[model samples]
Target: MQELTTLKLIERISTLLRAEQRKKYSALGLQPVHIQTLDYLASCNRFSDTPAAVTDYLGLTKGTVSQTLQVLERKGYLEKQQDAADKRSVHLKILAPGQKLLKSITPFDVFIKAEQAIANKQFDSITAALYEALVALQNVNGTSSFGQCKNCITFSEENDHYYCLLMQQPLDQADIEKICREFISVTNSGLV
Candidate 1:
């Protein structure tokens, strides 16, 4: 019963954190989805140097990823080039403008603002407790064949954290193995 209650609280906190990111990212001309795509592209060292590597890492539906790539390309945030080794394939590379933008934007600012709503240093305690609960849950979920964030379609680096744009949640290694449909890998590279 105690564990159940803690899980419930974590769920609620997750929802609130998501809503906060939505509101903040929206203002930057990005929805969580856009951030996810960008985040994935930036994470892999290869993709960091060759943007087109994003498609391979993400395993996205070709058409959907292509469309998203076009949007980013058109926006001048990414550059596309034909692969030298495989002329039939294209490579996407993050441009100077894109890096500049990502460096300037982060949803953590919202987290800090929300933290102010609590009193007496309670926020830290709550956050720490929640993390502990999540770790406990992970132990139960982690014994599977796959880790969530590592294998997820939407897991991506965002502002120093692994974010899932589809579920609007952070990706945990354990959660990915559960094959949860709500989560996907995300990116934080297009923010600034």
Candidate 2:
């Protein structure tokens, strides 16, 4: 038998994970894209809470994202609000029901068991390796990084205050942890 290449292993793992997700989604009468949009909204910062960002992150068409958003909104999973600054733009906000649904559907047992099995250092190493692989793939595809605001080159901390130079806005602790679509890699800002 041939040895599995890195890409093959990753693809197999992804397929298994998606299969698990599909089961949970089907039980709740939700599609994979619906769950993905909810998950993204839950993690993304204010700057990345728009349909355009969702479309970019999911690599889906505007029409598809629009329909998904409409369904989620109609189902009381999310709300679409006109941006205060940009009246023409809208922001997607996951509601409490969406949060509850996400919590119920999240696959935590596998991750919990994996964490319990791996040493802290080993887990950290694995995380770093996976992040590197994701970066490589994103670079190849010219896709948005959607990295944590705290990890971006534009992030700064001073006197207990967090700020994003790129956005020219102050960030709270929660905001700092949320993912940003405009994330500039701290290690590869020049390349970005």
lDDT (CA) per prediction: 0.55, 0.76
TM-score of each: 0.50, 0.58
Tens digits of lDDT, candidate 1, 105-177? 6645544544443323332355555544333333323311122454445566756666676567785555543
**TM-score for predicted model 2 compared with the true structure:** 0.58
Report clashes for each candidate as comma-separated counts.
14, 0
> Cα deviation of 140 in candidate 1 (Å)?
30
Model 2 steric clash total: 0
**Lowest summed lDDT window (length 10), candidate 1:** 183-192
Predicted structure with the largest TM-score when compared to the true one: 2
lDDT of 2 by residue, 1-192 (tens): 112245654664465457666777888888899999999999999999999999999999999999999999999999999999889999999999999999987764544444443334332344454555545444443556676788888989999999999999999999987778898785446643
Question: lDDT score, residue 34, model 1?
Answer: 57
Candidate 1 at 41: error in angstroms? 1.7
Q: List the residue pairs that clash in candidate 2.
A: none
Q: Supply the global lDDT for candidate 2.
A: 0.76
